[model samples]
Target chain A: MRIVEAGKLALESIWANRLRSFLTLLGVIIGIAAIVATAAVIHGLNRYVAEKLSNLGKGVFVVQRFGIITNRQEFLDAARRNKRLLPADARAIAERVPGAEIVGWEVHATADLERGEHVIRDTDIGGVTPAILEIEPYEVAEGRLLLQHEEDHAAAVAFLGHEVAQRLFPNVDPIGKELRIGGARLTVVGTAAQKGSFLGFSQDNYVKIPFSLHQKLYGTLGSVNISVKAREPARLEETIDEVRAVVRARHHLRPGAPDDFGILTAEGINDLWRNLTQTIFRVALFVVGISLVVGGIVIMNIMLVAVVERTREIGVRKAVGASQRDIVQQFLVEAVLLSCLGGAIGIAIAYAAATLLAANTPLPAEFPPWAPPVAFAVCTAIGVFFGIHPARRAAHLDPIEALRSE
Target chain B: MHAAPAPDEVIRTRGLVRSFAMGSATVHALRGVDLVIRRGEYVAIMGPSGSGKSTLMNLIGCLDTPTAGEYWLEGQPIASLGEAELARIRNREIGFVFQTFNLLPRASALRNVELPLVYAQMPPAERRRRATEALQKVGLGDRLDHRPNELSGGQRQRVSIARALVTNPALLLADEPTGNLDSKTSHEIMLLFEALHREGHTIVVVTHERDIAEHAERVVTIRDGAIASDERQPRPVRP
Candidate 1:
């Protein structure tokens, strides 16, 4: 018989028992739903994180005592003899690396600042050099940034961030006012242009002071962090390598001793975030994939019961001259049809639910182009794999016994 | 001993023994039975219960393989044919009507009759056409859409007979075809069988009822798993 005729017969048999057929398809529907929904949500999260990391300055690289990129280091000791790259080393790289522009180091700490009645406590205090406004991406809004003369005398002047300036001198100008920091008082020189938010924290809240005044006030408590800018995008990797080698040579460390400092670039951070989410996504897919196996088992069980229930029908078909293979194929077709139909429903539900979540929730989802078709194909294959035994049993039935069976 | 017959001999059996394994012991259904039947002959196999008459009917219908036998059906040894080939033979050459009116309960009369032809792999148009003709011949053309549950017992039997005749097989095997019918309906079936026999179609019927067997000219009596008598009344001329 033609394959189409065989399929028609299979459908006829399935229609004969509608309730049983739907119950069998139910198992497959749930299986595909779980996998598709979870993967879409995780995929969205991965995208959102990469977007945040790339929003920082163009080709910016941070060298700190602890990794700001992929790996987490417990210790922060760039002071090791061969690890610490001083301001002298920074200047040498600024002149040596061809496409390198300005390079500067900054030390970070929490500080309490007071002006008359307004006080800001536990605010970020950055100890930056005179070249920070150029090398760092901090733009100037009002007054000029600290000049080279100010750094040589270890100037007591400070640059207020936008939030701090508005808080301290509501109606008055902050560029010429003096504010108490940690203990000593310093004059405000300039305000940084808006940097917006990074990772969830406001970047507009930190205060920048000349490195000499920061050291004069909090020398024993804080460590140093460095930032560099590349004149051209192509020279970034070469610049980073040059910094690494120069820092190591200044510290005079032996080979193979682990470097105490860490370097972070935008691309490096993006990769780290994807790696974390992908692992979680795979684990979720596998956990949900178990449902597919359950669906297949359910089909096998139902087919076997159908074989027993329709023993007489089997006999009637055989008595008329159906081959063993014909009987088997008919039943197998019924099973595959059920699974394919069920799988389509599953993918639809998954997609609809994912779309709903993406629209309403912060974590959005995106389905892969191949997911629906591949899911349907797998469901059909599973049906055939599980439906064969029952079909064979029906085909091989003896006509006499089957005719007699109730 | 058996003598090989020509292809025209519709059914020939010699020393055909069929035994069933009943628990630990065996029950012999047919013991060294020898018989031969020809085309266009209306033969009624009559016997008492436990006389292996049903066993012989099943063997002749190719529904069961024998324990040991030399049963040749239309020059083809049925014992040597595999399961599928036997099924093919049954479809092409044998049509059966059981006493219970064995029709698919859910299907309409037309669809029930079309079943055998469907298995024969006939195209849809031909199978449907032939099924229509067969049901019309049995006088159930108006009841084609009605299921077995909706039809009367006698009408149901007529539909079963229509199913048996649809394929135009070599022999119509009716096992107690009228056993479940009232006398009036039985008489109607007998008239239909008579007409079919006159139309040059062969028929074999198995029944214990003497009155049912009297409708055929040839009657074979089986006893103790073998043929006890073979007798035939003189041929009556058609009107």
Candidate 2:
């Protein structure tokens, strides 16, 4: 039989038994919906993580004593063995790596700052050189950034972040104001503009001061973190290798020995994010796999019942000269049409659910454009897999016996 | 077994044997039967219950394969044909009208008539046109959109006849065509059959009723899985 005719017949039968058709579609609907919604959530989170990682700076890399620790045992082991990064290590990298643009180092502590009647507790107080601004590139909203001569003299000068400026000197110019930091008074020279937040932690809550003064006040409390900016993004790998060689040489490390310190870059964070999303996607696929099996089984069961119920119709069709292939094609089309209908509905529901999640919750969701077409293809595959046996049964019916059934 | 049938012969069977397994016992339904039917002849096969007339009809209609026989349809050896080829023969060479007026309950009369053409893979417009013409020929042009249940018994039977005739088959095979209808409706259906036969259509009606069989130009009676009598009538009874 022609495909158009088979489609028409299939539609007529489905319309004739609407309730049974709907029941058969339920499993497929839920299966596809779960897949689409999970994909959207995962895609959204991947985009969110990418955006956050990008803010860590383009081609910017950080070299630390212990690195961004991901495991407890490894972190403790690294802390026990690795030497703390010193100001000399930063200077060595700046001199050796020709591809490096600006090499900056920083050490921070939680110190209370008091200005007139306002006292902000546990404010981020950091020691940095003038080059830190070029590495991190924080926009100065007021006054000017610190001068290199200030760090040379260990001058009592500071730069306030946007949050600290608002907290300690609200409604007044923060620049040129004296703020007491850890019993040392420093004049604020500039206010860094807002840098927003990362995963709910405010990035604009720190204060910057000269490295020499930090050493005099804190007295070697925490290890320093070195920030390096490559001349160009393409030169990042070459600059990192040069820096690694210089730092290792400065520490008198032997050849073929592992570096005591750790190197981190935005690419590492991207790799970690990729691994996390891959795990999530796998779990989602497993769930969808189970649902598809259940859905396929349901469809097979219902199609078997349909074949039995329509035995006489099958007989009539055979009597009218319908070949086995014709009968098979007809039933297959019905099953595929049923599955595709469910898939379309599921995709629509998933889109709506994703939209709702992105709008109403902190969870980010991105509905991929390719999702609907891929879902439809999977639905067709499921139908073909489950529909064949029943269709063959209908096709191979003995016309005389089938007609005699009822 | 006899030799192959002539080209002009629409159906021929020789030494046809069909057996059934009822548990351990093999019952012979058609034991060593020979039959022949020519084109443009209205014939009826009559028998009592368990006389194997239905089995013979099934073999003749290509609905069943004989266990042991040489059967031919239009000079082609049907016993050697595959299921798909047999279906093609049924579609192109035979039209079946059931006693139950087995029109699809949900489809309108017009759609029911279009069934065979649909399997033939004709385009939609052509199938519709042919089905409409067949229905009009069966005097059911005015009831094109009416479903089976909405039509009277005679009308339903007429719709079945329309469905059968739409394919313009070489033979019109009816299985006790009036068995489910009342006497008046049965007479009307028989009259329609007579009209079709007068138009030079080769028709076969299987029945146990003598009155029904008397309308055919020839009658063959079966008993104990064999032909008991075969006779020709000069003047068949009018409906």
Candidate 3:
């Protein structure tokens, strides 16, 4: 028989017994759904980390006492062994590194802020030199950013983040408002524009101040985080090496001694992020692989049952001149059609679920254009792999013996 | 030893023997049965239970092979052909009608009638056209869309007849064609067979009922795997 006619026969049989077909395909549906949902979540998270957390921008890097550490014990050990970066390190790097375009020192701590009767506790207070704005640009929603003169004179001027301003001066113009932070009175110069959250952490609940004023108020409360920008992106590696040599010279370390400071660039952070994403993807693949195997077995079991139940039909078809190849082709087509149908349903469900999650939850989901096609190919392979045995059984039946079966 | 059959012979069997292994014993079902059937003949094979008439029918239908025999259909040696070749012969040269109608229950009457044509790999429009014509010939043109369950016993049988005729085979083989029907339905089916035979189709009916066997132009009665009598009636009972 022609493939098209066999396909029609398969469809008729599936439609004839809808509930049985659905029950038989349940395992496949669930397996494919799991795969699709995992792919969407991983795709979205990769985009999120690349955009928000990598901190890798053109010609940018950080010099801190401790690098980005994930393990708690390792972080504590690094903090104890690494010397605090001194204030003069930033100036020394700017003077010595020819590739350095901008050098800035940054520090941050959680502090209580009070403005009139409104008070927000545990608000992030960031101390940064004016040059830090050039290294990590922040959009100004109102007024202007801190000026170079303000940082040189240690002026008590501050920039409120979007959320901080919303909380401190709900209905008033926040640019000229004065707020008390850590018992130091400071005037709000501008409000940074809203930058949404990343991985559930709010990015807008903070304020920026000149590092000179921060030193006077908090008396060098913590190690400085030095932000450096290169003159050109292509020269970032050389700039990092030049800055490392200057810091090593300033610290008076021996030629072979390891430097006590950490250098963090966008490349390092991206490597770390990629490793994390790869681990997640591997685990997801392993889990979905198990489910796929289980699903294939289920389909095989059900196909065997179908073959037995239709023995008489097979006999009748053989009597009507169906060759063994024709019988095998018909059954295989039925199996493949069943799996592909289940895969299509699974894809539709996963897409709907991803959209719902994107709309209502903090977790992000993104659908890749190639996911459905690849998933369908895998499903068809599974069908062929699991279906061959049952189809062969139907093909090998003796016509007279099969017709005698009740 | 019999001479080889002429070109006009549709079925020729010589010294046909079939046996079965029943535990430690070999039961010989057919022993040296010789038979010849020509084209455009209506023949009935009748026997009591366990007389090997069913075995002969199966061998003649190419559903099973004989142990020691030379059988020829349409001048081709069938006993030596392979499984696929036999299947093709069945597709092109034989039409089968069963007492239970044997239509695919879920398929429409039109689809049921199109089975052999589908095996022949005919295109959709042509297969449908031929199936429609066959159903119309059986006076079931309006019931093309109805499923087997939706048709009466007589109509269902007619659909099976239509399926049998759809391929325009060299032989129309019926096994107890009226076994499941009432007397009136049986007579109606017998009349239909009479009409088909008059149309110059080669037909064979296998039954144990003398009344049903009487409808054919010739009757062959078997006893203990051997033909007891072979008679040619001057006129068919149904005619």
By DockQ, rank the candidates, best first. 2, 3, 1
Error of 3 at B55 (Å): 2.1
What DockQ do the predictions score, one after another?
0.46, 0.85, 0.68
For residues A264-338, what per-residue lDDT tens digits would candidate 2 score against the true structure? 998897888789888988998998889888988898898899999989988998988888999999999988888
> Which residue pairs show backbone clashes in model 2?
none
- On residues B125-234, what C-alpha lDDT tens digit does candidate 3 reach at each position? 99999999999999999999999999999999999999999999989999899999999999999899989999999999999999999999999988888888999987
What is the total number of backbone clashes in candidate 2?
Answer: 0
Ranking the candidates on lDDT from highest down gives 2, 3, 1
**How good is model 3 by TM-score?**
0.92
What is candidate 3's CAPRI-style docking category based on DockQ? medium
Position B5, candidate 2: lDDT? 79
In order, the Cα lDDT scores of the candidates are 0.81, 0.89, 0.88
- Candidate 3 accuracy as lDDT: 0.88
Better of 2 and 3 by TM-score: 2
Q: How would the candidate models be sorted by TM-score, starting from the highest?
A: 2, 3, 1
Candidate 3 per-residue lDDT, tens place, A127-236, comes to 88888877788889998898899988999999988999999999899887799987789998999889888767888999899988888877885899999999988988
In terms of lDDT, the poorest run of 10 residues in model 2 chain A is: A195-204
